[model samples]
Target: MSLLSKADEAKLKGQLQDAVISCTERCLYSSAKWAAELLNSFPETDDDGSETDVDSAMSDPPPPQTPTPSSKDPIEARLEARETQKYLLAKTFFDCREFDRCAAIFLPDSLPKTSFLVTPSPASKSKPHGKSKIKLGTPTKPALSAAVVKGLSQKALFLSLYAKYIAGERRMNEDSEMILGPQDGITTNKELPGISAILEEWFSGLANSGRKPQGWLEYLYGLVLAKGKNEKQALEYFIQSVNCCPYNWGAWQELSTLFSTIEELHQVTPQLPQNIMGFVFQIYASQELYQSANQVHNSLAQILDIFPGSAFLQTQRALLYYHSKAYEDAEQIFSELLVANPHRIDAMDCYSNVLYVLENRPKLAFLAQLAMTTDKFRPETCCVVGNYYSSKSEHEKAVIYFRRALTLDRTFLSAWTLMGHEFIEMKNTHAAIESYRRAVDVNRKDYRAWYGLGQAYEVLEMHSYAIFYYQRAAALRPYDPKMWHALGACFGKVGKVANGIRAYKRALVAGSFYDNNVGSSFGSGEVSGLGGGVLDPEVLFNIALLYERVNNMGECAAYMELVLAQEEGPDYDESVGDMAGGVGVTPTTSKARLWLAKWEYMRGMYQRSMELANELCQDGVEVEDAKALIRDIRARIESQKGDSSVA
Candidate 1:
């Protein structure tokens, strides 16, 4: 026997038959008018038929078949047929919106009778041949209207198909096939033709209907299209929405975002809403879209009819100018901001920087002081104040501020470095070294910290440590001539003469002139060993001394000659005047002239040497040793010439 009982199987068969009959009748009725319309619209050709042929085709007769009820009651078959006809009529009337007629069809008098039966197959001997079964009472109709029933059934079928599609049943083949298939002999295009036109028509209808879309639906729909599948359609929708609601910030915001995504913000920046101008400005600023940002700023300024008084905006504009190296313009704006808002820490900080750029240390100090009054706890402000004092050579005060800055923020490397410099100026070598080491620890890349450490070590006679720091500084700032010069000096202090020479050459190439760091460069100071300071005379003399120490005697003599030629006064008179003032004293001009004479005589230039000696003797100011040496030289010249003008 089958898994289902015979009675159950019969009941299920009866329901299935009823459903099939109902569906067929509805399909036939709906198709009738649609088919007629298709036939009327069908084209006539020689190969096909004329209008009369089409009309005849529509009116063609169907051959009748004799109704048969096999093994079932005749009343049951007739009732089922009548029920199917009622179902179809109700569906048609409901589709045409004839609700009353549709409701009457599914009333209590119209339902079909249901029956149960048991039957045995020809191959199954265990079951009886057949047993007819029928309900004794008439069937009761559903209270709901036939229109509602038809709609519910259609809705259920559509839902089932949608669920299957979502579940990936048949791989989307079912939906695609049915949607593309012909309906009522009318062929449907596979791909949507004129979809754009359809959408335009829908939009036009919406506009003409004057129905306001609720909430942000209209905006959201436009936004989806704008960012989703069709940007042009989305734009049209957005424009319509904007026309409907001019103050809609959402539409404007979405439209602005769309412009940014496509990098066409320049075109849309002017169209942004005034209320959300800040957000638009932020986006442009983040992207570093300066030209567009400026344009937007101008437009916003006009719209608001007021300049932004926010210190932040002023600082931002100032920073842009600073980055472009427009120091004057940056200074003007920064100063204005500081004046307007005295408590703006950033403005004060930037003002200090601008003053530094202008080389106005006094102004920098003033701004730094102003900043400190507002925020005395700020380490950067304290450091700036310390820098100002340090530049003025007020090491004690500089140290106080620097130490205070470091106390507030121990990681402030600039303050640490400034403190180290103060110690160096005060000749506290060990303290300077400690401070510089702390700076290096705070910021390993601080080249000035390493250089200060080197100088402090050199002052303490720790040549090796000095050399190490100098090397590190050189590595950090290889292009700095001062670093090269410092390295050379460190090498020289450590007795590395050859290395020192090489370093000096590097310093020369790096643009460190001999007089750059010397005392004479600032005047009123004594330069030991070289005998002159920063003056041209001192530099030439130092060059001569260095050459002589290196055993370049000819070079030493040549530089000495250059010095003598450039001297403003007579050599002997200048020597006398220097002696009276206790400055640049030479033992005797006669002796120096005699040495020069002997040097020229040895080089076979006797006439030149004799003339130099004569000029020296003619000055009438000679020492006893110089006079005796001159007498002996005159007797020797008389003997060589055999003149016999005996002395």
Candidate 2:
């Protein structure tokens, strides 16, 4: 397509380089003291030193040889100016939403490989390495110098690629919710438009040139591969990226997304540079998986000694508490964060969640209004608004706001999960499942979405499917009692008694360890309609019920006794169990007493049954059943006495 052939283009680029070098050398020649510095920078020559004359020397009169104002290298100064100009122009185009123009300024997709960005230098072909020779041809490296190239690579590369990616997403502003994310989910990234083809060809060109990608390019490549769902290759490139430039949080974020399980994370974590940034990545990963609460707590504690003022580290701490169901602790941190940095909106969505859970509607509404006033269109602000509506039971409006957040950024994982929650509240199980699936698609490490899908499936009575989903969530948050508890319930519903018992036991151990190591996540006898079950009296009662299901009366009675004993204290009365905030057995007390009484009666312990039934009767719980039980016991005793007298 070019008028010149490859040979002519190479010769032209060489001539241009010579002019730039000659102009640079002539400027130094004006300062005789600097003339010697230009010798090493000149082009290679023949052995006899009879070489091509400098292009400007062949002219009759020389152009002005004045040194630059700063006494800087004229060529280098020009490159700096050009770099800045191009970057500012590209940034302006991006701000104006001219995404294609913004990207083309750096990485033009419409043209052939014959652009100003890349020029093959004949001198660089077939470089020697020991006795071997490595041929590097047609490199993707730009003609810019090391310093100029580094400056441009920092901002232009990421921004330009990000622009291209957004364009390739093929989004239309008017697209409906159903169109943005279908029933299957937003798995359309692999179907990116022509930009993807162009990028692929360019990447191939880099590979063919025998030059590995730069750190930033590797990061971009990983992002593209991740978007296309080539996770394994994406992971390798991400690792390479961090090795090349370990301080880039952007690369770490993309790298962390590929890990769906803690095992995968653990395996890859050692390979990552264990610098300060890598430690931050570990904390971030812990928050995402919700598994290593202890690591999040202790590791963040140590790191905060170095960066105590970092709001991000503080939010990770709050999130750790949130995942552990320690809402009060989490709320305190969030409140402190907002007070210290009033303009911060990074974790407002999480703060809103804590408020919503605590049912502090006034604070929630205030937060919503504050965020809306600050930046109403941010995904976090939209989520806060959505939570506000959700707290008010405005399910439809909440969903609309959540959808708006997703429309702005579909990769906003919280929006997808929260929208699914709204759908679940509206009792639209199918829609909820779709939303949750989309969340998982965006980041499989988001255990909340997996758990939400499980809950939705559970609501639909699809116990088998619910178990599968719950297991996925539990794997991410292995220490989370709620996830294990959900899995146990699903197993029970599916008639997998042994698996149910094992899952319930995991819930019990997880809860105990959590309380011991991470503080009491859920306080004693506390029941949250929104929370997953823990190793409280409720779990004990479930274990008892399951044991009774399998006809294991001994274990059933043992667990029932444990359930009631937790409520028993020196100040507690038998009648205090059902009282709110009581030291007694609490809301599940009556159920446990009824089961224990029935078990006693079955085991011929009629007197124990009578005492328990009498307590239930006095407590005004199971009154009718208690009366019938008392009558039957009394009648049986009279009949037994008659038989004894007859004998």
Candidate 3:
């Protein structure tokens, strides 16, 4: 029983003839029966050893064994040999990295013969009448060459150990034994890498390797590449990986993230699942990647054409429409979704928001109520209800709802501010002030709250407090003329006249006009040199008269002009006429004319002034005093004429 085939022996001797090949004394002749079985499966050789019956030889059963007398039977001996040969061939294929071929060998020829073992029925001597006796051949021992047995055993051991390694059960010691054992048949020096390590190395190599790999290896490689810093490289790898392995979720996830990070999401549109369309919409919505989002939306529509009953896809389409601001489409879809699933919270919120934005207040209110019924604790629903009440001027109801919203979300600043506004509208100044204070406490930099607080204090006549808030508001918004004017008025109320004037100057600098309600006007209680009161016609006239006394002719004329502009025809006559008569002028006469005459005379309009004085003299106005004043004006005019001539 030779341990090696004659060919294998000759090859070994030839290798030893070359001094470069050396084997230690421990190197025993381990048969390569498994290697021979694999080689035989390749094809049969011709007389010249060229493959002649290639396909047929590969399909042939294992070689026949020399039967011995001890064997059970000829059939049993041949069957045993065939089974041994099949095991050896499987082992050899596995060692050669031909896993597909190894798997194929294990497949049964037919369904019923698929079991690994074959059972034989017992022979019976009973026969029909007149049947002759039949004798069975004696069983014989299967004469397997020692070399083939050793090789087959080694191969079987290697395969068993490899299976354990692949199943993640082989210990490091077991792997080391398989690699370093004398009977270990694999030529590679390294222990068979663990499945995970092999997978990792294969992934790394495919990711860095220019050539493309296929199957799960390609998909895993793409995942590794996608995580790498080089995005372009990752993109290329991901495309290849997904193409190779479409079922790999890792590849899909990495592709999604990669496209999202670079914002080149169009690259992933074709591959995105309908289930993740909503996620895709969210990414584009956040980044404002409209074109890519639209493509994805279109893709979803295509998928829906194929799978129209997909509820999840319909929801995603609705969200896309919402993001695109196609409110009509969104409303339609959400309405459908709500009808289908009555308790859809997100759909309710989205539909409500759309209505709110569209200014369909009643519809928004209805939706908000429904949403509240669905989830009483939802703050957004409460906020929507508050907005509805606020729009209707139901300040009390608005306040209650806004407060409820605050209870749900303590940090809701807009709710707090809206609550303050409602209190203000309700004329609850103290409560308004407290609400604004709370808003400011929540957000110290809220300029609107500071302004609101200032207005509340102003309304309460708390001048100093008002000034404090007004200054804060002004500091936050220096360009606001209203704040400047309010600060000026507050200062004036507290008798800080100089400060008040400065504040007014600031208002003017900020482009405030001093007409009626703004800047140093008696109108609207913003008067200089006067107490808080409505503008009085007589007092204004007196102020004009005082301006005349102080030689401020321009100011005096301005005041008179304002009076004339306000006083209309006969009413002006009656008012001015009564005042003049009290000062000794006739009733029904125009006193502003007389004042104008005096002003004209002082302004060197002597001829015009004399004409006015003469008219008054002829009317018997102010009787004795009018005539004397007219004579004095006439004489003074003549003296001015003489001086002009001399000049």
Residues 1-647 of candidate 1: C-alpha lDDT, one tens digit per residue: 11344455344334333323332333323223322322232223343344446466654633212222211334334434546555566657655645435545543223333334444356555543343323443223233433433333221222222222222322223333431133211222211122222233334554554333322334545644543346666665665554443334345445543432324554544444333333435443432322223554454334222223444445656665543335677788887876776675643544554565566777787787787787888877887787677667788998888777765655566677767877877888887887888777645556678888888888888889889998887675554446666776677666675676566556545442222322210112222222122123333444554565677878766765545443332233464443321223232333445555665665756566667666656655444444555555676676767865542
Poorest stretch of ten by lDDT in candidate 1 = 520-529
RMSD of 2: 17.0
In candidate 2, what are the lDDT values of residues 1-647, reduced to their tens digit?
Answer: 11344455344334333434432322212222222222222233243254545574644433334332222334435533666778678777876778778777876543333444565467545553443232332223223233322334333555676666665554433233452444224234422434344455556555544433446567667777776678899899899888865544567778878777767889998788876557778888877777545656888887665445667778889988888777888999999999887777888998998888778899999899999988888999999999999988899999999988887777788899888888888899998888898888878877878888888888889888889999988887776777888888888887898888898888877675444223222222232221122336777788888988899988989999877765653334456454222235355878788778877877778899999889889878787888888888888889989999999
Total residue pair clashes for candidate 2:
0
The TM-scores of all predictions, comma-separated, are 0.36, 0.73, 0.29
Report the number of the highest-TM-score candidate.
2
Pairs in steric clash, model 1 = 520-533, 520-534, 521-534
lDDT of 2 at 228: 69
Q: How accurate is candidate 1 locally (lDDT)?
A: 0.50
Question: Which residue segments of model 1 deviate by more than 4 Å?
Answer: 1-361, 388-394, 512-544, 557-647
Q: Which model is ahead, 2 or 3, in terms of TM-score?
A: 2
Error of 3 at 362 (Å): 5.2
Q: lDDT value for candidate 3?
A: 0.50
Q: Give the CA lDDT, 0 to 100, for residue 469 in model 3.
A: 90
Off by over 4 Å in 2: 1-88, 106-160, 170-213, 291-295, 513-535, 569-587
